[model samples]
Target: MSDEDSRPVHIRRRGLDPADELLAAGPLTRVATGSGADAGSQWMATTHAVVRQVMGDHRRFSTRRRWDRRDEVGGEGVFRPRELVGNLMDYDPPEHTRLRQKLTPGFTLRKMRRLQPRIEQIVAERLDAMARAGSPADLVEFVADEVPGAVLCELVGVPRDDRAMFMQLCHGHLDASRSQRRRAAAGEAFSRYLLAMIARERKDPGEGLIGAVVAEYGDEATDEELRGFCVQVMLAGDDNISGMIGLGVLALLRHPEQIAAFRGDERTAQRAVDELIRYLTVTYAPTPRIAMEDVTIGDQVIRKGESVLCSLPAANRDPALVPDPDRLDVTREPVPHVAFGHGVHHCLGAALARLELCTVYTALWQRFPTLRLAEPAQENRFRLTTPAYGLTSLPVAW
Candidate 1:
């Protein structure tokens, strides 16, 4: 398919043309998908200023609307349940504050540093397994997707034997190509698992993030609340890391100088990871906030209960954000971007994710310096209509 024809589904769903003056047109514009869910027209913030503004003002804008996934998508949906919404992203103010206070310790820089050696070990082991599998390998299956899945299993205290089932549930939840019924079923099953595990944790609070939350919060938090947070963390990590790894590799290969730098040392790899995250803007989070009342955004008044969507990619790519926004230069100095979002809802797993990406990008190329894409970038199927965007599979060779 032509690049024009194969534009990201989110852009299409929002009814915006890529060639249009996205920034010059204005910060806030209205777009409607064909679906009846948004027949009235939904507001989209397409520039850095407006997106960051909408995200920063939580009092005027609310995330309660994010609960209904299918409705928000104008039909397309994921497995995460609005009913089980206890994550920091799903709440505002005091409720979000309480939850974040308890969960932040588990995601602190100290913990991420401690987890670095293990991540390196996992990346190396996965690369070794990929080597054994020989040429023309599927990077998504062998490395990109599997690495995060395995890491998530450990981070959430899932047993080694259950990683396969866990990944299946995650894939079913976020893989946009899957039928809505299947995705919903996966979400339901994960909730069930979390509930049972929450019950067990209430009794013992074993180890790892979930367990630590259970131990730390105790009677302060309910089973439902705890389960919701865990589910959010797992789903968020599963999709985001996989996408970054897959897309980051493709970006690096397209810029061999960057690839060489990424493979050089830890500092270079960290720089490469940040640049990739900024360029890819994979999460596209901080979208879809509902106005609490008369929310004035950039001279436009969004009346009560109006839907607001922030275009993270457009925001990240804004020329005002940085010079030459389209170029991918790993050596460039890191600039603030909305990839992890902004404000109180910034990604909790940012530290750990950086560790993972830094470790994998550097080590993978170290293990296979001759690695190259086995298929054209366009030939690879992308997971569209999902909350987070990424490849379905990346065929590669060394």
Candidate 2:
């Protein structure tokens, strides 16, 4: 291994702060991503503007493939597990547009607003569980971890009995420490479950997202597409919200006033949710974008086929993006942060995430006005290895 790869580099974060290297990466810098399919040198977009530019222009920087080749749409020629389908992030326009258009109706602001009562109920139930678990409860286990999965099950129309199984599969698939074979096995199992659910939904549609898609689009939305949708939703809905809820609570715990700000009023709560998403960009980086052609971003010329990883945390924390970027301020006027990402492949569940967060943050504090950490913040384990950054176990007291 080369010296750069040999050197320890934390690309994600040190607690809530972006890794020193990422923040100091200036506009664009070449960085080695140790090992993976994405191993080797790539351009890192640190500033908000550059990241936005890279993400916004899909033609110049392709999300689908590094080279211009006409293979089958969803990983046909590519050597990946067959179960990985319908994820919009893995495709470019036309294919991406078609799938996104089909899924967009289900995640509209109106749909999310309609789902608010249920979201509130989920939060209340989670908080009650935490309360029953009593003081010094592990918030991650009792509240943060459970709520998102439960809510996702509800959204996706997985049976109550199957929710636990579904969550288990999700955890198994997403746990980064797991071997690739193990993770892929979990993914295959998850895929099998989704495929079965899709088949059932097709036969007898229910009120959930899968059923709604089945009923509306019918054959136009293939089983592969539906499976992909569910997978993406599960991936997006579970970890991102779970992490935000866990870490947002931790952040708010430190800033007592921010917790109050979340409980203040609708407008303040909305602003607080947006601000928190910006501050704790738990989805550390978006899927790395491959340059379709030689593109000059800042002073650097990214050659064709080169990959660019935009640091969401660093970009969000840039002084150019917001004043006093490091400090968590819920009261600040909302800025366009790439927390959910920018442009075409931006998070499909952004509305649902925001709704869940707004509901949870407001209700959690209201339910337990005296909520505080059971142990020192330093003792809490941060989930650094996972795709989403969060607390592994947050012991809390009311």
Candidate 3:
């Protein structure tokens, strides 16, 4: 079959209509571009086709411009906050490679192994807090949101008392409508806070990852760069974890049999995590990229500097790469998924994300074998207007 003809069939499943609107205006449908849902076309069945075409030809569909636009859109440019939390995601080659090299040592398997206990403790504490709150607790607030935010703060050397402010800035920064304004406000506040923290670390460096980054790249990274790095780590790391944890929990709760399987076999947790990542595809929109040069993708030729978005949710669900693509089969043999992105811009915190996910699923199931969604799944509030997809609240009961 021709490449275009071979594209996956995009299905319009039911859930949040707002998300459907966002997906419709996305590159998948060849619709108009802007932030909100109303500025675009109605939901179309061609989204899957668009995703297949983009992923199949990366050369023509460059992520270079997308990475640059990340900074332009509410991240370290003009009205937005500066990139203070720098590890690797935003940089291109050479610079990206250098940053990744320095950061890799801290996220190795051995390091994750060491961090597991703390992760477990954090999970347990959240679960305990949930239990104390009794039945019908908001899982998103208690477990999904709290655990990741706390862990990221700990990793970055931010004290526990300051985590609430960090989360506020993060939430505001991700809101598309408020991004410009909130980013300006939060960026300024965070900059001052980060500068003070960096000065303190300079005087007496702590033993956290932030301290390490400052020690090694202090001269190279300006005060703004350091703050940007902190913001990047916090934003990138916490956003995915929160969404994945919520989705993972919802998936397991939806399929009690799968939860039983997970409980029966510890190995099931890892596979389940993969399935959740693939199924949920939290980073719904592909980070937009601009074409550096003229390129042909399938039947279309995108001119240089034109913007293209690679929708991860649509790509992960593409029937071409995955068998029974729509089905949530935790037992499916490992197939590569782009939930953490692909190629050079792959997520640096993949290891930590996996750790957090695995720990939460395992511990929550083991602790509350009777755990189930306290409210009807339909009643749960999914995120409507943010760059990342997630639930607003996940009420759970045992």
Q: Root-mean-square deviation of each candidate, in angstroms? A: 4.8, 3.2, 6.5
Pick out the ten consecutive residues of candidate 1 with the lowest summed lDDT: 10-19
Better of 1 and 2 by TM-score: 2
Residues 179-275 of candidate 3: C-alpha lDDT, one tens digit per residue: 4877778767766787788888777777566677667666565565566677777777787788788877887788777776567565767877788
lDDT of 2 at 145: 89
> CA lDDT of each candidate?
0.76, 0.83, 0.67
95: Cα error in model 1, Å: 1.1
Candidate closer to the true structure by TM-score (higher is better), 1 or 3:
1
Identify the superior model by TM-score, candidate 2 or candidate 3.
2
> What total of clashing residue pairs does each candidate reach?
0, 0, 13
* Model 2 Cα shift for residue 191 (angstroms): 1.1
Residue 336 CA displacement from its true place in model 2, Å: 0.4
lDDT of 1: 0.76
Once all C-alphas are superposed, what RMSD does model 3 give against the true structure? Answer: 6.5
TM-score of each: 0.88, 0.92, 0.81
Q: Per-residue CA lDDT of candidate 2, range 1-398, in tens? A: 64323443424567777777777877888777667886778788889999999999998887764233644323346533345468777778877898888877677777777778888888888888888878879989988888999888888889988888888999899888899999999988999999999999999998788887778888888998889878888887788888998899999998887787866889899899999999989887777888777889766899877888888888899999999999999889999999999999888888888888888888888888899988997887887566678889889887
